[model samples]
Target: MILPPHETQAERDASAARFGAELARLTAAAGLPLPPARRLTWCTAEFEGPPATPAPHHGAEPGPPAPDRARLRGESDRYPPHLTLYRGRLPLAEGRPPDLLPALRAVSAWLAGADLAAIRRTAPFLHVQEWAFTHERTPLDRIELNWRVRMQGLAHGPYPVAREDVKALWEAAFAQPRLRRLRPVTSHYTLWFSSTPDYPFERVGASVEPLHRGGYLVRAGGGEPATVATAAEAVALAVAALPPEPV
Candidate 1:
């Protein structure tokens, strides 16, 4: 997770602790049993770009390094530092009860055996918010899929759910909502995190101009700090090592 340079290690630790505790508390309050928190790998496409312009409070500290302009388009100030693609939350069979490690491992191995050419054909995209001044637009034809593997509790807290039940739930939630709006967007993964504790907003909002140029920003995060993968390469490595699919 990206952090402000100005914060001390103690502050960072404290913040993380608070975040975790609140997460746990909220889950329990929702009447959802907490899933066994374990280390798992996830995959996502990230936008390679420059660090954001810091807020006024950030003036005391030097900002992140500048991005490479040669490889990027438009003004350097046009976009945020990152955008995520697919995110998978790996399930482990141990401490949490229904260990999904075996099934996770199986999926990883299967991915390894499968050809990435098909996957890569759908090169990752950074969805950026558009700005009236920029007059930018995202290409509609790109193939994008955000895949994730996570516990049902983490995905939809307080409400007990299983992998098999996700499709129906999603249809009821997302599909139904979209139908009402007359807009349709297909999602290839499950929604694990609640809309609360809105984080990464700084990073997300910074690229509003670019996002409008693109269609949407795809991002994912999991319960364990050790499990989050920030880069696509790392996610691929984990997927390749995953075991076979569970029966």
Candidate 2:
């Protein structure tokens, strides 16, 4: 078996600092000034550069030198220079570097032209949207829901929810005897029930999402979602929809 490289916390931090430094250098070199501090408070600009060095790895006691170990680590991870565009702390776009100078120029132009209202309106949808730019022209002003192509469910835009409502929904779901066996996972404004208790939660059994216009949409076993006006009605519908056997 191949042993993973042993990396200390300090070493990891140093590596991160190096990456950040390189990204900053590239941003300047490309003439893409960072957004103002106030703008950055709500959004961020980030770059993902090609690896500067080969990754470290362990080998047999009398094995090859460090250089050789890096070679064995494989070349697939060494991608081309790219930007990791962000909204707040979350990355909105990554992977597959576009033309470096062209992309940076597009980003610069976008930053200069974009307004606070536009950013504010787009920020919440960043998780389910994608943005791209090229030297040919700056990207479109609007961010679209491109997530459906990759992910299923939610035939329309994202389901919006308030923190207070989410807490109330979680408590209400827990109080339901039928849903007690299923684990509750709240993500992307949707509350999912899964048989597995851990992160992967492979066995999803039901879901509840708040409708944009008002009301909650509850679904079970891949069936159609049913909307109800009140949280009590939503919870009751969810409990009734669940499988009779314990999940």
Candidate 3:
């Protein structure tokens, strides 16, 4: 398995500072101006316990979190707070003039933290329910920011290739006559075949990895890899290099 990178708390803090600085600069350039009352402000709440149990009747208007439970705070991976954009405000109707989309996007981007795609999608979206602060308050944005922040703190990265994209390739490779007896193991983007069930990383007989532009790269134990144009060719190459099954 590919391990994630490690970082100290101090390092994470520094990264957060850098992210905040860039976000501020980008928001300023987004072209929306607001008064102090309407400007976004970070706010947080601490629940006393495992919710009131039975979770207040459905559709019942929720009250403000206890005053002591609420406070304005800075960014944090745990117990992340939200930025309140407005007080008792209604959403702008569709096609409203002056288009406050920029402000909404800024808030969403802030909440999305390091998730580049989420930030991009928020620009055209006015509100994201998952990230909402409160029903009475402005709709929240970037509900997943806290998780993203934690992942960022841990230096986790998105997978290079989606598993679904390579499912067929693995299936085809496993079907090859010479490779059929070998068990396929995966490590991130790589697929390895080993006769042993344990299949230690170093002992795999053959491995295949997808090339960036378009192709499969096949490698035999510690040997140079050969890039093939198609999955079929890659499977054939790997099968040829694989060791014969035990008697």
Best by lDDT: 2
Clashing pairs in 2: none
lDDT values for all models: 0.25, 0.43, 0.41
Ten residues in sequence with the least summed lDDT for candidate 3: 88-97
Worst 10 residues of 2 by lDDT: 66-75
Query: What is the C-alpha lDDT profile of model 1 across 1-247, one tens digit per residue?
Result: 2223324667646654543454345445554332412211121111222333333322212344332111111111222222121111111111111212222222232223322232222222222122201211221211111111122222332223444433433333332222222222223432222212223212110010012232222232322222222222222322333333467
What lDDT does model 3 reach? 0.41
Candidate 2 per-residue lDDT, tens place, 49-81, comes to: 222233232211122222100000101232333
For model 3, the superposed segments whose C-alpha errors exceed 4 Å read: 1-165, 199-202, 245-247
Work out the TM-score per prediction: 0.19, 0.33, 0.33
Error of 1 at 45 (Å): 18
Task: Give the Å error, residue 209, model 3.
Answer: 0.2
User: Of models 1 and 2, which has the larger lDDT?
Assistant: 2
TM-score of 2: 0.33
